[model samples]
Target: MTWVFLIGAILSETGGTLSLRMASKGGGRAWLLAVAAGFVAAFAFLTLALDGGMPLGVAYGIWAAAGVALTAITSRLLFHEPLTKVMALGIGLIIVGVLFIELGAAH
Candidate 1:
């Protein structure tokens, strides 16, 4: 389904971004490979979702929102990064914005 692909894109993008961070911190060959593969899969899955008829506006909005939220949460869990109240609020806003985009597309 389109939703499945979209979710995959979001997760892969998140993984790629996290791997990039790790690579930057000297995580070496494995991390670099992961970063490259993750990004490649992310874009591939995103294209599949679009091919499955998910509108660009809605798909991209959801992808960006979910990626950011998941990344922030994962960062907090994996790296003990600070996730302040402001960051939470921003994530919530992104979700709301995506919801609005989806809703608007239905009309």
Candidate 2:
């Protein structure tokens, strides 16, 4: 389903972003390859989601917001990065905004 593809896109994008962080920290060729693959898979999955009837605005909004939030949380866990309360509040706002977008689209 579209939702399945959208979830796939979100996860893949998050993976790509995390891989980028790892590569930046001298993870080298393997991590770079992972980054490329993750991003490629992400776009492919996103295309599938759109093809499967998800609206462009809604799909992209969810994908971008979820990817950002997931990447930030995962980075905090894996790399001991700072995720301050203010950043958390911003992520929450992004989710809330996406919800509003989706709700508005239904009308």
Note the Cα lDDT for every prediction shown: 0.94, 0.93
For all candidates, the clash counts are: 0, 0
TM-score of each: 0.95, 0.96
Worst 10 residues of 1 by lDDT: 94-103
Task: Residues 1-107, candidate 2: write the lDDT tens digits.
Answer: 99999999999989988999989999899999999999999999999999999889999999999898898889999999999999999999988998998899899
Best by lDDT: 1
Per-residue CA lDDT of candidate 1, range 28-87, in tens?
999999999999999999999999999998898899889999999999999999999999
The superposed Cα distance between candidate 2 and the true structure at residue 69, in angstroms, equals 0.8
Task: Give candidate 2 regions above 4 Å deviation.
Answer: none
